[model samples]
Target: MSCLPVCTQRMKELAKERELEHGKRIEWNDWVADNLVVQFEKLVFPRRSQLPRASAVPHWEYSCQRLNHAFVRDEYSQLTLIPSVRENELVLQFHDFETMGQKSDGEIIFLDDITQAQALPSQDSVLHLLPAADEPQSAGYFCRFAIRDRSNANAACITPLNSGLLSRQDRWKRPRYAPSKPIVIDLSPRDLGLAEGFSQAEFDIIAGLGFDSEQDMSWRTRYPTATIYDESPPSVLSHMRRGKLLPPQDVKAGVPKVLIFSETGPLVIGGGEDPYFDLPLLNIINELNASEDDFDFLVSIQPAGILHPQCLPSFAKAVLELLKKRNSVHVFSVRLPDHGISNSQTYIVLLASPICSDVPWPATHLDTKSIEEQICHLKSKNPRADDTHPTAGKHVFLNPAGQVNVYNHGTGQLPDATDRPYFKTVDFESNIILPTLYSDHGWLHPTRHDILTVRECARIQGFPDDYIFYGADKALRSQIIASFPPPIARGIAEAIRKIIKEHTAPGLDASTFAALNLGGRPQKRTRVD
Candidate 1:
């Protein structure tokens, strides 16, 4: 097994005697085995007497949780079809089974209908057909089989075929690893292609994982998606589909709802640097909130990727609840699959930037719960926006080589203090960088670092703490976070609410807000200042 070396090292640490006490030494395969190709479900397990300890093999869920942002740019072509393992399932099988030591002529063999086949579990067929001393495991052996009857599916018979043979004169058909471009096959159901059934973001991820074996199997060779300029991922993750259609929980069918992104956390700055300009974000939100009485929901998403999944949910829920209790606003989090929030029906988006860090930080969740707590401890070191909460830590402001003016929250101020301790900052997993420099943060002088806390990022974008991102990669988390439209920025619903209040009941005015009065598209925001 690929993980054997790691297992061996771990076993030694446990001591031979310590493992013996567990009853018996068992071998388990989690990673791919020495034989490169496999249809794993058919692989047999060892006797229960030699079964491995539950904790010895890693959990698939935990394995997924540790995935980093080592993302391939994107796979623009090809689709995936997960074949079922049910008795009624039909699958493709190929073989060169002539135990008489025969070679195949390089001619291709094709079979159209695969419905008559019954599968032979490796348990009943594997040991009988071992690879020869020189044959590689990837030269797998497969054959078509069918059950005699539904009642006798427990037993099966092999089917006749003009078998594929690589004779002494011709070589076996060598499968190409990379297809410089998408391999377009003439499969049926091309007309049944997905319509509006899948969202853009969900589809991209699915295509990424499926094409690796066929698309990115080599080093050196290049594909367009692997290039930086080509970022559109071609995969679609379908487990995100839903069986039920439920109405949104936080608002009435007629009321205006508002989603906010409010994170603006910061890092240590060096001497005389310009502070970041974070005022426009907050101003936009407050303006919209103040403009209407028809608004029913007030959602806030928190920063995520580092803290537990609750960062988004916790931020959303807290903000929503607080709004509800204080002003009768309703709020909720966007549900996701396998703990990931979905983009479907997500009406607004938040976009925020975290405060510059004095040191380096990682976005890994290897020890998420514990590591997050340590990062939270850093809040005690500075005069943060929410000083009572004590957020992100370990920063010393250096004297900026230059400086500028910046504004944020309710008041605009100059943050010119970088001359303190040498701002040494670090995140839960990132390596070290001294601090960040700023471009428009009120001043021209640069800080020792780049940007802010995940939560602060949430705050700037108006994502309520309750909305969660299904990731541990900071950049992915950021992209998902920023793609949203902050309810405050839109302001259309509320402005319409005011016109409705003076002119009608329940909903808003149609004269100007609705399409009845005039135009094609709604008015667009032309200025940010």
Candidate 2:
């Protein structure tokens, strides 16, 4: 009989003793000799049926005194137990039966002398005893048994007393460590340019303009060659798609681009015998020179009507001519009525200039129309516009009691006394007026019933009180005042100046400088004598 069962029981008793008193000295050698013995007659041998007759079975003996170094033999194999006693531990080294007279690879059990705690050898010691299972025969040993040491106490014993190996879950839950690699990023020249050129406010606005929907992603995937300007106004996108107009994103910084804000009626489409495109262009260039001398030019054209599709060719031709002369030009259409002007008519503004290329073109065709639509939409939401007030109009009268009475038109009813102020009538007024003080449907003075004076109109349009109108006719003066608001012009000018300042300032990289000076034009430096 093998002594494994008795040795395991004695290990539990020694563990209890160690827990009770750590100073107790254990007689490990004596204990091993008394309890650790293997009887060959009573031990169950493997492959008993394959062994020779009972007489051919090799005889073996075991004594309690010599158990420290003993062997149990059978017909096929022998098991040798070699015990070594140290101050802290008792090592029981087992030899495999396969190799005769040689120390075949086997498990080494470490038993704590005080606690009799059983554990396998360390991983390093195990690897020293058994080589990696690269061969099919060696692989079987790994699959059948699990070798572990004190580092992992949950491992199964190799002895027949506990034949169970570690479960699959236990092996999977084992911790593993691996080396990590570094991360890297590469930025292009254009990316660097954008990074340096864009301020926080501009970056925020650009970020807001980016679309990240599945539909947008799918559209991008479908048209891999499309650019950011592909979905812009049809007029601009058509020119861009045909390689006539440069995509806004491709516009270079530092170089001045012509900005043209022109009305469609006078330049190309409206029934004008002689188009005054060059006059407006020259006027804007002069204005930019007077206001911002450092910049090349900013031209704003205010036309009387919306730009129709049929007029696009003429407009494109005009733009191409400007581009040929200026190298870059951005066009925009501005509507005066959308900007709090008393007039109700929409004016087309065309802006073409050599400003900062970093700034995107403002006022797409839809954007211009959408502003008017939104204003009109808000007006339509007024309560007085409802069908219930079919006779509603801006007609006010003073009753004998000094209260304001409103007269309902087309209702055949007398004026009714109302608590609502007279100014509220303006809220329901939807008359579209031209840029003239004497127009029948034009703005009325807030306190008086007379039309707004030319000076008042100019003030409403962001002009200073002292600003003089050179035109002799009131209508002509009104037209001048209504063309473009001074505040908006100042804002656009300041923005252009800011863009130029940021892009052309010193300290930028050589690549950025090359990018800004697109034509490889040599810088004009003063000759030092």
Candidate 3:
């Protein structure tokens, strides 16, 4: 076992940390050659084939540390490039060095032809290396080499090809085609060498991988596909959605809205005023740490078809000032397109908080009615698609008045008075509050509960105890707190800050920064003639 002469002290330390089997050491080039042999065989033969004899490819032990030091110390000029090697158009790079199990980077160099070497047959030939766990060292080496006499090439300068500099005819087919969508491969937990009952979340963390810049881009472009060990196709789709590689189809942007809390009731500002009537909400912007210049995005909270030219300028100015002062704020408008909900009134005074769900009900307040019986009763009454669903009535409470639960309606939009309220238990274990049903219209806890108190809703939304939601009625206060949860707001603000920092980072080109803002795609406009 010959070890390369460089970084001797560090190599010894690494060997101690990552104990080598039997203290066996192998040179970097030998590892590369072994991998190339395995990959080349895979291309020529079927998977699960018996191991073939190693190829006669010449594996020269080159020191990556020495080469990098040569470049750093300006000794590259002393080495001469032979014309024959240049004619062959071979590539040589200091692939990397490893001591024990740790890897250290080496220099990259391009090579061409050399004398007394077997010229590769016209470059369409292939080598496909997939690293195996058994021989960890013989993995990730992606270059093909030609065998030559040791005396023919200089010992001081070794040439290895960069992984991707293939001949025009030698490119791998289907690198892009295969990964167009995520792939699902079935494997049992036992097959993956896992104990019984390994949870899905644990599996995901174990399967996740990180790659370097070059390799990362390569995999992203060539293999955008995700491999799911589970057999379920929906699971694969769900994973991809989480990765943001697949945009969610049902992501409706929340409308810009403003609610003013008062002792009388919660009022939707701007009944007689201009569309930007809630511009006064900008006062809250002073609480943020950022200056006015930091704000770059805006949402207009206008009621439909109610533009006020006279108030427009002032509203715009207020918004600009708010942007300069706050980290992030979103505006939701009262008018929603295709929402089927009414927006006729500019201001709303909710009489009291509606008890849309059973979340606030104590065990003593819950009815003795079995959840199954309630679901069956609800299904019998309202057979409409908007009424019953597979999971809707299960584990969910129903109003004896046959109200529609928000989950059952499935509209991703605000509800109106016509909709009756149905209640469901919050997934308290997961910290997720189910959407509020139209409880103001007589939705009740099985025990006939009323809407949650202003403080209760605030707590569920992750608001601190001190934060208050004061308004006209319990219903109105609940609406204000429920519409915008504190946790959701915090997540959005953090994401915005990160994006802003990336955009404002020094040395980022305009096109790249713009691409980041637009999500790395050319922005297209809807043509309206």
lDDT for each residue of candidate 3 in 227-252, tens digit (9 for 90 to 100)? 22232223333344345344223221
Q: Which candidate is the best by TM-score?
A: 2
By TM-score, highest first, what's the ranking?
2, 3, 1
Per-residue lDDT of candidate 2, residues 1-529 (tens digit): 8999998888778555544332211222222224222211111222212322443423374223322423333221122223333422112222231221222333322222122222233322221111112224332112212211121111111211011122332221111111111010101111111111222112111111122332133223322342433222333434433557564442333334323233322223333333433443343333333231122443444343223333433444554444433323433334445444444433433433332132333322221222223122112212354467744423222122343332211111221122111112232233233332121224443333333344444444544433434322334333543345544444445455454454344454435644554322233454333
Worst 10-residue lDDT window, candidate 3 = 349-358
Q: Write the per-residue lDDT of candidate 1 for residues 1-529, one digit (tens) a residue.
A: 4999997787576554444422221111111122112221121111113222342432223111222212121211111223323432222222222321122211121112112232343432321111111223453333222111111111111222212322233212211111111111100101111100111111110112122322222200212232111111111111111212221232222222233223322212222322342232233334333332222223223222102221323333332323322222112122111111111111211211011001111111222122223223222223553556533223322222242211111111223233112222334332221112221111111232433444333333333333333323333223323333333322322332332233233233333333342211123444332
TM-score of each: 0.17, 0.30, 0.21
How many residue pairs clash in all the candidates, one count each? 99, 23, 33
Model 3 whole-model lDDT (C-alpha atoms):
0.26
lDDT of 1: 0.24
Task: Output the worst ten-in-a-row residue range by lDDT, candidate 1.
Answer: 186-195
